[model samples]
Target: MPQDCERTPVVRDNGRHQWEKDRARAPRTVRATTGATERDTGLHPPDLVFHAEYRELPAPCPLAEAFGVPAGTLLLERSYRTRYGPESAPFALVTSYLVRGMIAANPDLLDATNEPWPGGTQSQLHTVGIELDRVEERLTARAPTPAEARDLDLPSGAPVIQLRKTSYDIDDRVVNIADVTLPADRTELLFTTRLERW
Candidate 1:
């Protein structure tokens, strides 16, 4: 999209006028410059390619169908709110996001909640997890497979969330914090974050 200023109106001698498109919005940019010698003009301007990137998450890469994750969806999730001893460490915004597909595939999986973050105190980010496509689960909320919870060994189903945290860095692809939804307002998060997998 054209992030630059709006276009200006043009008035022609013929009487009728129309808005002229700004060069900035042109997908392919070009410049014409003059030099002392005909050969003085050198390399053309380098194209500025802009694309979006999520914070600290690996580019979303697709997993398998068994995991119910879509291709190009980032799976390795890690967010941190603070260093154990210091307040200066950046606070994390990515704390209780949904669990990765690897966690969902194990045969020994038990009843699990992705981000059922503990209710009170902002001390930790408690991202809640919601099941996708009516994924099967037991009354205890464990995946039918018990071994799925064994390998990585992160408290079995309850892994102390490794969240993506505070970022002072804003590159071309930046998201406004106003756009992020709170845990209580998760119905919106489903369409944007969880349904598709990395």
Candidate 2:
């Protein structure tokens, strides 16, 4: 997809020009110089679409433990699956959590129908006057559950890389947490940090 502000032709209605987003293009997760998935391997971009939905939980789960929240705390859980073109396997599975109380001021944030938000979570938080300061990701690898293996179409013995991403605001309060599952054979993780010289 053209990255640098490629404009689609305007359509006219009642002699008024209307701008429409190009929906055929695959959705992107983050900014990348090349392709989003090619940071380490220069892999070609796959035809992909991201599907997301809100999950209802009866009680606090692992996410609550990671966030140090009390059990049974109500959280907004959003689950995502990215699938490649004409393929039964998914590129990855990702789920994100946010405290419902933190964003209750913006009713739009609570609805799944408003998802695939134009600017992602940062934009969503901006609506509520929150600014993100930094993000941290913890990583681990493990065997997939039988259901995961079936969903990902992994070969026997294939591992999956799991990531727990935490986002903090300028006040240093946790704003968001995300769990990601990546097919070990096709995914890569890269981290860069800058340091000041003495």
Best by TM-score: 2
Tens digits of per-residue lDDT, candidate 2, 1-198, equal 212322221111211100111111224443222232232233334444557799655336677776667778788888877554456666677889998877889998888887656546766777798777677778899999998878777777889888787888889888889887877765645444447999
- How good is model 1 by TM-score? 0.17
Report the lDDT of model 2 for residue 13.
22
Q: What clash count goes with each model? A: 36, 0
Q: Tens digit of lDDT per residue, candidate 1, span 1-198?
A: 121322111111111100111221222222122111111112211211111122323333432232244545444333322111212211112232222443344422212222111221110111122211111111112231333223212233332222121111123211111111111111111111235667
TM-score of candidate 2 versus the correct structure, residues matched by position: 0.72
| TM-score versus the correct structure, for each prediction | 0.17, 0.72
